[model samples]
Target: MEFGAVSDEMEVKAPAAEAWKVYSTLQLAKLVVEMRPDLVEKFEVVEGDGGVGTILKLSFPASTPVFTYSKEKFTVVDEEKRVKEAEVIEGGYLNLGFTLFRVRFEIIEKDEITCITKTTIEYEVKEESAANASFVSTQTFVEIMNAVATYLTTKQL
Candidate 1:
């Protein structure tokens, strides 16, 4: 059995190239943490390049605590479309309640200096972990996108 999906979109003030540079690289979690360590305690790349098959381990701050540690692997990377998809292979959300968790990020060019960032989260819950479903929030991705947008815009100037 599977739950529904959630999707969010935000327009960034930076160009598609800049957004792609950040998202298409394995440095995504690192870059975001560097800009906002308050939100993330640490981000480590366990394996692979920014491309498909990359694995990233992430730790969150106690303040916004969820899963202290999470391991994710990139399942898809389409640079030409500026889209990347990752799945939770281990840790964090899975340990909490989710049976399956995956996210897809798409950066679409709106103009020479602007782009739209879209994130879609698809998940399924374990029967025993239904109560823990509340811990999963799509807003987290929106906040991350906002943070990344701010960082990229600042670096562009």
Candidate 2:
């Protein structure tokens, strides 16, 4: 197996607690789908709440060349650290030979009124399908960060 990871960070003009309120709950998922309908067709809750063990089924538009849907379970939700991790349990990268695919979001405080949204993508793929690892990218996370930051900043005003 081959493991790979990629990360990206975005600075937001909002408090860490404010950012965590969204990242640590299903609000972030709903915001993403509402803000970017072109990227996500649907966001459904399969089980659990917004805490650890929560399962989310995300569907992409038919125009998406890759897999149309993915089921991810929140494996980690550390309120103190303002970190959340979700692991893809079905579809998505799994169908592409990836044995593991996890996305981690960390809200780090920069100051009382500034914070950084860090996103990390970790995946393991069969050695023969190592080429599939290239599909993993932090671009989508960056987009989410942008949307969230804009939403939070405007909502505060």
Best by lDDT: 2
lDDT of 1 by residue, 1-157 (tens): 4385888999999999889888888667887788778767797889987789999888888886666778899999998888999999898778877888999999999999999999999889887877776666678788889889888888878
For TM-score, the strongest prediction is: 2
In model 2, state the lDDT of residue 30.
96
TM-score of each: 0.91, 0.98
For residue 130, what is the lDDT in candidate 1?
A: 76
**Whole-model lDDT, candidate 1?**
0.85
Query: What TM-score does structure 1 among the candidates reach?
Result: 0.91
How good is model 2 by TM-score? Answer: 0.98
Clashes of 1: 0
**Total residue pair clashes for candidate 2:** 0
